[model samples]
Target: MNMLKYPTLLTALCVSTMLLAQKAKPVKQGNKSHTDVATVEYLPEFTREVPAESGSVFKIKNKRYNLEIRLWDQKKVRIVSTVPMGSDTDTLTNDELYKMSGVTLSAFGKRIDLASDEYPENRVAEVTNIQVQGLPAQPAKNRQDANGAEEIVVEGYKTTTKKQQANVGEVTVVGYKKGGTDSSGKTPSAFPNRPVKDEPASIYGTQNPQVADVVVTGYKSTWTRTSSTRRNMVVYIPRDCKLVVDNRYTDIVVNEDLDKAEFTLYRSNLGLRNVNELRVDASFYTMYAGNLGYADLKLASGSLTAGTIDNAQIESTGSEVEYEGGNTLFLKSKADRINVENVGSVGGYKEFGELRIGKLSQDLTLEGKSTHVKIRQITSEVTAIRISTQFADLRLPLKQLTGYDIDFKGDNSTVYSSFEKKEMNANAGIANSESLVAAGVTFGNKAPAAFHVKSDESAGKKTSFNITCNNCTVDFK
Candidate 1:
């Protein structure tokens, strides 16, 4: 960023004055009118001073003219011509010299600000206040783009200003904002960019109309079911979505538009096997429902919030399973741990039973209507567990869950387990939620003796069940 120098304006005017004088002169053809001009010659001459020389040399039309001229620090003007009509030598008349030097330094001085040079700053006037003084009343004749690439020249002045305000830093910006509309705008948006499929609404009053599309915003998600289970429900988790995973566990987010969400489930010799570890990764998927109902809903790295409507039930069987979507998801029996990384506005219903999680690292949130959630064995390090309710109790093995920091947020809930009864001194806190003890010890605020649990080895190595409450309470018997 450089400043403007006013002296340069004078130098430019010297050339402009000469041009003006040439334009004013009319042509006198042999037998033609004044408009019948033939041609005009513009000869620019420069006089150079040879140091230690008696005088100087003038270069005119590539020819040298020996003459005497004085310069003040190479910034002086000199002119001498043999043509008496346009000469500006000492012997020439005032009118002749003035006409020869048609431009005065003052004229050029007024426009020196436009020069890209370093000099006195703040020379360029505010373009808004300064109008094009010498412009013609009407605009110049319009010019069309011959090759369709329209280009127009814009001429204007620029200025700089500064304002100081309290508590805020000084803001400096260049002001060149004023101009006509753009000659070329961007192309319009395409028509009906794509297609969307229509899905029928559920008639059971427990399900809403199926959504053909699901868009994920930020890739953080939570799959929460509440404290109740009026009946068994199935939620289909899809597979065509993004998955973010670390060492402990993986996250699933099904945020994409699909024509349909369907799956087939296979029944194992047993139910969901607690013997083998399982991992869940989702994108888009179909499921196979064996004897038990399965939900073919895809869980991405987003909030897949669902609650039991009537008595819907859904749980994945630990058997040979395969699913298909835009992208195939191979959710093998290697790991099956779930967590709610973050929460957003989620709308839907999800139900699960016979919980079998291989690992649990992040925070897990469970809430819904008469929903049943059971995590048989959390064989991995636990971060935090939060349980809430329309009506339901979270059941898990206490010995398998170990972490220095464990947070329990539940409401009117109960925890039942059969992994190990050994009590360890672990810091536990509760919030506004109530707690119930059925078959094992419960961790939360309000604890009642009616929910006490008696551990039995016949319940198995990793056997657990939970009775979350909605509007009703039941017994373990």
Candidate 2:
């Protein structure tokens, strides 16, 4: 025994002891800290992590519009709005916009002049490829003055107005909505204006009065950059028109001809609590639209399910996701290369890909050729791990693994090695790896209740140990 190396071992032991004492959860730089799942939003230029209750409704100028906002109760933000009203221009106070629940602005006549610092460029820009749906319905049939002909409701009128370099402006009838003010129904004359009701009508009439139609039309234009500095743009949506998210416009786009200054989309954070459906569609990358960092994912409490590749390729170079609470994590993509860490539990299908876990609660089944499957900790009473890789090599530093069942089935594909100090009471099967190392498995102190290791004489290589049990027998041909 060399006594000099004992001093070096003591020094290493001391350093490792301090490191283990200081061990903590890995923290990534620039990771959006989410307090709750519901208050997270992923927009082009806007990345905000707000509290759950910050999502509320308000009314502005008797018009109801949903003010989707990202609010951090602990911090402060600067909000600005420039709106085009009729032939005149108007500006709305942030406080006034916050008071609106669902505001309806006429689409037939309006141009929004907007600017904001909440954006990156310090300039408000127009959003093209504007798609709107579910607008207010058309008014009831009214007779025309000329020929007693019923007026027709235009599907969506489109007309060209002005054209400039790179910005060809046009107004198109977009969408419509229902509720706002009662311009449709006029006050009826009571017996030729004999006398108005002294008091209001019965109860139900107190509800919101219905308006005729709320049409949204505007010149969807694009702004070009003259300088190299990053441009920030704020898109102004009518208070009533809920911004719809599509895969085409869900990412940031940047190119030589047109560069993206900044992009963002926000919604009232109410669905965080009641939302049971979570869909992830990630397949595009542009200056205007691009892959949203994990910071861009919206959080909800419903049973979570993800589609095949939420985006085209989720590049997890220096990123990790921290989930608050979920029972299951389903990987539905084919031949997906998903990098996951720090999840509570997995209760779904994990047929392909490599899963590296800091902790696990259930069994992990790897049937296909998965090269780097690793498990660090088992926080359950019983942990079952099944690996069917072509070359199944188990390398884990688990502390309290009580039971295990391992079945290896591959030709010249499985490599068996163990560094466990204590023999685990496990049932294991090694087949067709075409290596003699499989016969050298030495059960430490405890052996599997039933063990089977079979290979033909031509396939048998060498054995370094024999069976020690009187009741248990080993047949080697």
Candidate 3:
């Protein structure tokens, strides 16, 4: 966040709304080209300084800079680079820099404010005078100009302006909001080399914007690509610093135990030995770790492998996971495939996924729909079992369930066990949709599908089941 200081006219835009407008003399906004104003120049050699406190945060923002972070005894971060770029400046325009960036405006009157991708979101001399100055002529589609906004489509740009009256309450803005995050944590430039003009619609009059005045500043910047390819960085960071990273597709490795690591990743991969705690919000992420004291993860379309986590809370979609074991596990998943070799206790809900557990020692409580659950062993440490699922499959070994008093209930699901299962309800009417199944399975419109089971022994630990099914054929072995 250490950017160069700018004059009051550059780098800030506010479009706050619902403010009461007032009657003020309208200073006609003048039309001016961005090229006539300030131009930002980037230095080739950049150094980021980290504070020597434990609360210091080191952020890796730009994707062009590839980095490897390692722990060191030094209190401050140190960067080692070979053949660093000379003091020359590389220039990039607002068009290339803010291409796919979202609109970042604050402070708006109760009127229309139109913005388009044709103009830079943070550039100088934009949104000037009548009809947005410096824009090339565009084709008029015979559309009526209403609400003080005139539709004008110029070459490679299309937008509207509404600054005609302070009472303007609505607007049409285009272009600057097309894409999501890129490699860098910043938004890509929304405009092109040829800039466009956006009209403020209305900023004065009885509009009661109520503020002294709405001041939107823009800066001038330039980007010139260099062929040096001198982006690889090796930095030694203090182990005590708390790191918050927004990472892209780079592979990051931390060789030692980290104090704490929290990050948001996109298509990135990471490897860590150990952490005090790790919190991640990611998509398309791949992580490999030795052990974590605690882990809270929300993921989509990726994979996670860890050795032992003391506590794990995860929510995933279409992801794969493999773990050795943990103290406790809580999961909510959809279309995920997970394998846990051993754990103290487990509780979760899933849909259309597969969960395989080698051993559950303490207790197990899970409920879901259309899911496949398999447990190799549920030891004597488990004193209670409460499982409820519909249209789901469950497979458990005979040893764990042998000494328990079980209560099972279902509508149309099948059950198999070592002892004789007392049927609580059988041959009950279910959904009429079962008529599409085998011909002789139903009595006219009613499908004979209800089922329930209870162990005859009343001695051992308690096991309970509650199920409601429609067209669900579950086989419990």
Candidate 4:
């Protein structure tokens, strides 16, 4: 039967006529929500033998079928595909399903490629038009005033004058004039008494508060989110066989262990646990992993949540990473946020955003244009921290730290540390950026100037902090 009978299903199933010739049984699927039933059909299996000298490593390249590929301990390469047809159509022949599927499978010389020209209905994605929402306009209110005299005396201030009342008052002007101290003349000051000298403000490090997430008027914000249908395929591959996958719009899950895997994904989803080496090139790459080692990711956006990464090299437009521990991380980004509970070390260059580390056990070397860094605790094991940034803020724990060294060169920047105002320019009492980050409070300075603060903790541990910044603030308290 033509696919028009099932408009929801974009194309026919994949069933060859050769298999339908024997004991053909039309299986029916129960209707769940709508008038739709399905019949399962397994396509012809494709396999290739590995050469004895070629090391039994199968290479798979797939651009179709959002399949779950599991690495298994198999002798050779094998691929199988299944599709569901409308069970109501018994008269529908197998030849029609095979032609509509456009299946293409080739396995030769340790290389296997399985794909199809046509995809199921669920492979299609739907995106809504760009929507713009804005705040409503506010009407202006009319101003009002109470009726009163033009030069009337206020409650506290009354008119004062010395007059010679000898009936010459008609010619001399002295009826009333504004004057007064308070009801009591003992105070020479005005009725307000100068406002009680103003108390000093208590704030350190960043002077700029975190801007709320608000869109101002006259700004047109247009955005859209893409969604995928629930349709997928399943594929089985040999265990630990090196894999190379590419460009598609589907969810890929590598369930078993893999020694090495490389992928180029666009508008796709991927998930894995342990991988010896993984290289990915994607548009919006988002993944969750545990114990992932040796990863190289270059993408437009990266949102990774991992347990530990032994080594990584990431270059992206934006990032939101939260990891437990890592050996070494190197990255470059425009705007990103990186939070590690504990790590051996971290090194990167960020154009904007924030970096937070709960407890660092090793060294931290960073360079940024405008990135606020908040480190909760720099362990004694950490020998040194080197930073360079502008229009940003840095906070460290100095009150809790023992003896340490600090070499700071701030060009038009402010330092808020020492227990006193002059001590804000002092050293060794406060931290770098761990001031109030946990409460969603961030900071930055608008102006900068030349200033330097140094400390010598020659007796305690050999920990040190060296920073050079412009228009920034360093808070150690």
Candidate 5:
């Protein structure tokens, strides 16, 4: 009996030791430090107080799955997942369900990466097309079925419709209440002749005025036309009011500071202008502004020319946009052309388009495929510039390069620059191309100014100008 007991005890001890070894083992990830998740512990919920930086990538993982979230330009977020078929498909645990909810995935400051140790694979998920959330809703697509019946298919799950109309001579003002009050606690009138007492109070009270008011001028007896036609007129708008303009066939012109007001516009053709924050969505129209404030402009096959903007977000399809001064600019376009003279901070995604920029005061970022870019100058205030492209050519003509750190990586491509050969640290034959090259240059004549350049290498907490191109040419002068 004693011998049997001793054998049983030894077997029990061996089994416990095996279990401990399995739990302690770590799984390796690609280039990253290994994490041990064999114990299967749940992580605390993540809180994203600030917006993630544009173009940053984040990851979320559970016991049996991994999900990647990429923040695209214009508040768009793309989510992709990796889980074997039929693996944890049903009966998901509480932690697994939360990981897939996307509630913790904030779309706007730095990258957030969270992982579980239970599942470890060195695989970088294959690039497959995925839909992104928060992009401008596309128009319904027309399709013909097998029975030859026409069908309209809308792509988005949510839709909103707003409509406003004004008679031939009367002016209409749609203004949000938040902008109606100044710092002095006064409710200003939206129009010149309209009195503050006559204007209706916002239905949405003072806390959060999501509701807007529509004030219309008295109808004129002389202007009694049924059909809408373009009329030349001048309009005044409130300094801090939000304005929304939607027109089909109107040519608009905005004048700069004709009056003592914040902005003034003299419209030779029928169009709406003025207000503090402006948003315009037009088709088949031409708009010109001398000096602009913050605006969100969307166009479909038209042109908009502006002189200056504090902050501007532009989205266009087959349109042309030209602006001179901008502090922060976000552009999203397809088959469109954008020309800007001076910008403080600019970043966006463009496809099959052309971008011509004169000078960058801060940083410029581009991420897209098959686009041509030309940048004239990089100012001393620039912190970092990053461009990732495929099948695109980039040209930069630098006025001076004393304060920049440059990195260029190309596959099946060439890098041509006028900088002295000694300034570059180049390596040939990188990943996929025999002619691939990685070049690094730190500008400055004296001791390099604590600046460093990296090519085909990671940039950690450093201000850099990083360019990655495939099947393209990068030229610097």
Candidate 6:
């Protein structure tokens, strides 16, 4: 064989072997080449323009993918994706890829920000002002239903009629009729009549000469008497009227706001779907409300349970008040137990009672005399906490007091926390035999004071706690 022919055959064999090796290699999962070749299709699901004064939110969604672009305070633009992630490229659709790898370019006035998780240096595209459509107008009341059904409009109080049956009695009478002969045609009488009596005793008494069984026809009539009965009707309150509930021995139930004010009191249930303000003053009764825009309540000896009140001014004397949720609460009471949970900005004063707050979203100002207070969770928005009590034991779970400035003043009262003894300042001028002060123990700061407790790094905003007690011991962890 020629040497050139052998060289050409060897070169061809080496090239074929390289191609076979490449084909035998396994492909890695989630490769871009594995994605479906079809282009992504987007359909408009819904567009919502949030009602706000300073900020605006425009949302666009398609199927299971949602892209929300929010302009907060006209200064920042946030693009959020609510689509779930897929395991591999084959499982992920084009919509998912658009959400995961898309960039958001928004401009407000002359300021613009480009935000994206992928391709940070990509060219920015100019965008025009987005035109947002307002919500659809609601139909008027008493209008026909959307499903082509006739709506029955009922106004005023409902009426019900009832009837009563009449009474009846029965009686029997006896009478006689005689058979007569012809008068002038030589007719004789069958039997001659003896006598007829006109007095009552002859008809009903003894010594009767003749007796005969007579058939008497008597008429008996039946009559019906009807009487109308009406129930106690409810008084409809106007929508704009402020609800003033003042009653004794009556329990009131307040349902959700149906753009009206509806209340059930005693035996009457009235609905006024337009009331926005509520004021209640009742004693020896109980009131329950679902939600109120604004409320002013005063109770001498009763209980009030409410779901949420936007703003409230509450006063109670020897009564229980339970507020499940609210924004602002201004409370003043004496000798009563008050429990409020999930509230923001609470300022109150209590005397000779117990107060328990589950969670606070903002600030808290409390001043009490001889009262027990317990707070479960205080958020980062709380800047300062001040408590002044006399002759009462104050217990606060130390876990809730992380990164707070604690100041306590009391006479013959005890203050205790979950912090250890070595984690407190305890070096103030009041740290004598009679007074124990735990102060200047800064948490989350680089330079710590004497006996400083280092809170968890993940704690929220730093707060200051100034507590004052009389004749008491202060302890912290």
Provide the TM-score for each candidate, comma-separated.
0.21, 0.32, 0.54, 0.58, 0.41, 0.41
Task: Give the alpha carbon lDDT tens digit for every residue of 379-444 in model 3.
Answer: 766766666777766765546554554444556655554444433333433222232122233232
- Superposed by TM-score, candidate 3 places the C-alpha of residue 238 at a distance from the truth, in angstroms, of 1.3
Q: How close is candidate 2 to the true structure, as a TM-score?
A: 0.32
- Give the least accurate 10-residue stretch of model 2, judged by summed lDDT: 32-41
Please state the error at residue 36 of candidate 6 in Å: 89
Tens-digit lDDT track of model 6 for 220-292: 1111111111111112222222233322112222233433222222212122222256665555556566677
* Candidate models: Cα lDDT each: 0.25, 0.28, 0.52, 0.52, 0.45, 0.41
Ranking of all candidate structures by their lDDT, best first:
4, 3, 5, 6, 2, 1
Across 267-376, the per-residue lDDT of candidate 4 in tens digits comes to 56778878888887877667776777898977666687878778878776776877787788787867888787877878889888888888888888989889998989
In terms of lDDT, the poorest run of 10 residues in model 3 is 207-216
Best by TM-score: 4
438: Cα error in model 4, Å: 34
Show where candidate 6 strays beyond 4 Å.
1-231, 237-275, 400-402, 418-460, 471-477
RMSD of each: 33.2, 24.6, 17.7, 28.3, 31.0, 35.5
Q: Which candidate, 5 or 6, would have the higher lDDT against the true structure?
A: 5
Off by over 4 Å in 1: 1-358, 403-446, 449-477
Give the lowest summed-lDDT range of ten residues in model 6: 223-232
How well is each residue in 131-245 modelled by candidate 1, as lDDT tens digits?
1121222312211111111111112211111212221111111112111111243111121111111222122222111111111111101111111200111112122211111
Q: For model 3, what is the alpha-carbon lDDT of residue 193?
A: 30
- The local distance difference test score of model 5 is 0.45
Number of backbone-clashing residue pairs for each candidate, in the order shown: 79, 40, 32, 21, 6, 24
